[model samples]
Target: MRDPFAPDFFETPVAPEPPAPVEPVQPVPSFPHRPARSMAAAMLAAGLVVGSVAGGAVGAVLVSHRNTGTSPNAVATVAPGVGAPAASPGSFAAIYQQAKNGVVTINASTSSGGPRSFSQAEGSGIVVDTQGDILTNAHVISGANQIRVTFSDGRTTTGQVKGVDQSADLAVVKVSVSADQLHPLPLGNSDSLQVGDTALAIGSPFGLQGSFTAGIISGLNRGTTAPNGRALTGMIQTDAPINPGNSGGALLDGRGQLIGVNDSIQSPVEGNVGVGFAIPVNRAASLLPSLEKGVAIQHPWLGISGQTLTASTADQLGLSEKSGVLVVQVVPGGPSAKAGLRADGQASANDDVITAIDGHSITTIEELTQYLDTKNVGDRVTLSVTRNGQHISIGVTLGNFQAQPSATP
Candidate 1:
């Protein structure tokens, strides 16, 4: 090591010459733009995977909220009125041009419980307002210590988390960017979205900036677990390719309106395999005011963990039909528990099976929760269930579902 205290150390050192300026490689949204996964260092991992035991467990990428916290709520779903009339998409270039600048890249540095240590994760976001507020998925910025939003023109700035609804997988992040830099995407009616409707996703997948993917609405009214295992109902399903870094990106309709926030992709390889999921923009729009005001969003809970019965599982139990969710466990003092609903205490063949709710047939946990979405807390619901081979109706007042820190991933 050189001795800095020496008298000769006072001499000035010559500065090195600056490198030549290189042309910036601008990412064109109209063309394919996906960066290899290796470039996106430390991408966050998603928890939920879709599959049966037979096909071998495949890992899809809808991340769970790692933070141990509480958020509870009425029916499982929350939204405003249905969307507007479907518009045709003959202008792909026009749609991309209109929304491109609004799309941004988010770099979140989160603490991993170690001192002076952090992990970097990337996700996509949209400018939701002129005040510098941006909308992104809750999990993308969850537990982040610092957030940076990079715009299409190569501008980056610090961000702050305004509010988060883990149950709904939605969040608002406010940045210090200039007002002129913000171009809020227009909110579209997700309820008006139909199967086969044109859908496009714009995000920074695999750290590739301004990447866009196109597809059609694959399904609707689908139920999936949120970051904390609370049910999210009426989700927009699409075949648009989404990857690890695509979380919090936009899912637009044919008319160039923001219809959903891309969140999950169902694939055996943790890559896009044609099936993906988004949080309906209508639901997100309905909660934006609350989120901007820094209020925690809530959803209804049933107080029980259920297993959607499958044909194989039903055959193992000798059931004539595998239609209903099997109650595995019920929260004590919960609404269901207070109403005398039973669970399969010992994995017995005679577990309490919910056959219907308010006369609506429920074959899967998704169906049961989807129906509850239309209901509210303190509402009385009649559940038709089979207990010990006997059909009976149980009236239970609904209770809010609480978030568990240890909700097993």
Candidate 2:
């Protein structure tokens, strides 16, 4: 396990700044549940830099900080597809057999070779349409000179880039496979999924063709980093052992519905550590049209990175609400900056509190960005903030956020 003291992570817009030390506030029991998160950061399991990728090696990209702590359970491993298929069609065996046909192995290569004369990377994708439209992680095919998608039936076809939404770290690739050859995985309503629900992961983990793993939805609305150093919001957290090549694979529910896209794995060694994350299918479904249109998809950006405001932290700062996000840094010329938002103050006495958005109470930085997802670039919204003791409303038009600060957000 990496030191919990180390740092790297989700780009709330720009990368996060180290949180200031806070005086402990009394824990308010009735308040929303906010887990104490380590300020530590890690790289996405598959988002290696272009240079490292040029060597045909997979470097870490997503940050996985939490170690579920040791338990007294006996060690045991279950073989895939051991359960009764008829009783639970959504069983591990059923989901694997039913979905593996739609799951495709993606091999990407570039002639700009380094160690390997031809740099190559392998990942997974899901067939989303009969017309050859498939979905995978953007980083999987990032910078590929050629893409080849192979199905369980051993049918291979040239893959064309449809479009990539780097903010979500998702890409749609189109192939010329016949409709009969394509078995589209049904996209499930992620909103219906809850913690403890069955989650089946299918993809090419570590280039192993047609692999399957079963686990439960460990968490929801989880936040993680994308390939482009941006924050991916509302991610699904699972205990399934997703590995390096599992990026862009299918994270399905027991019913064999594609609920999430397997993307981030929790590992210090770029392997599986039992925890992994997936982009919710709802997020992918929302951006599918724009992706298919070959247009850039824009997720709203406030351009400032801050820490989650804990109830204890909020009370320690003398804030009224038991919940709210503390503003630590406001990027110059960002929507919040232009609206005159203040960064962390000389001490905790001065940190600006983002209390609400349009009236929706915000308690975490994830909630803030998730709310922004409902809006678009150029859409104006009123922000309710508490600076010092006074409450103020600031109207700001959100700006479109790309990779990094190329002239503000």
Task: Give a tens-digit lDDT track for model 2, residues 287-357.
Answer: 66677667777767777766678777877777765667777767777788898888763327577778899
TM-score each candidate: 0.74, 0.74
- Residue pairs with colliding backbones in model 2 are 8-41, 42-63, 43-61, 43-62, 44-61, 44-62, 45-62
lDDT of each: 0.65, 0.65
Candidate 2 stretches greater than 4 Å from native: 1-91, 113-118, 311-323, 344-349, 405-409
Worst window of 10 by summed lDDT in candidate 2: 37-46
lDDT tens digits by residue: candidate 1, 265-290: 65554345677788787666667767
Angstrom error of the Cα, residue 307, model 1: value is 2.7
Whole-structure CA lDDT of model 2: 0.65
Task: For candidate 2, report its TM-score.
Answer: 0.74
Local error of candidate 2 at residue 309 (angstroms): 2.3
lDDT of 2 at 132: 69
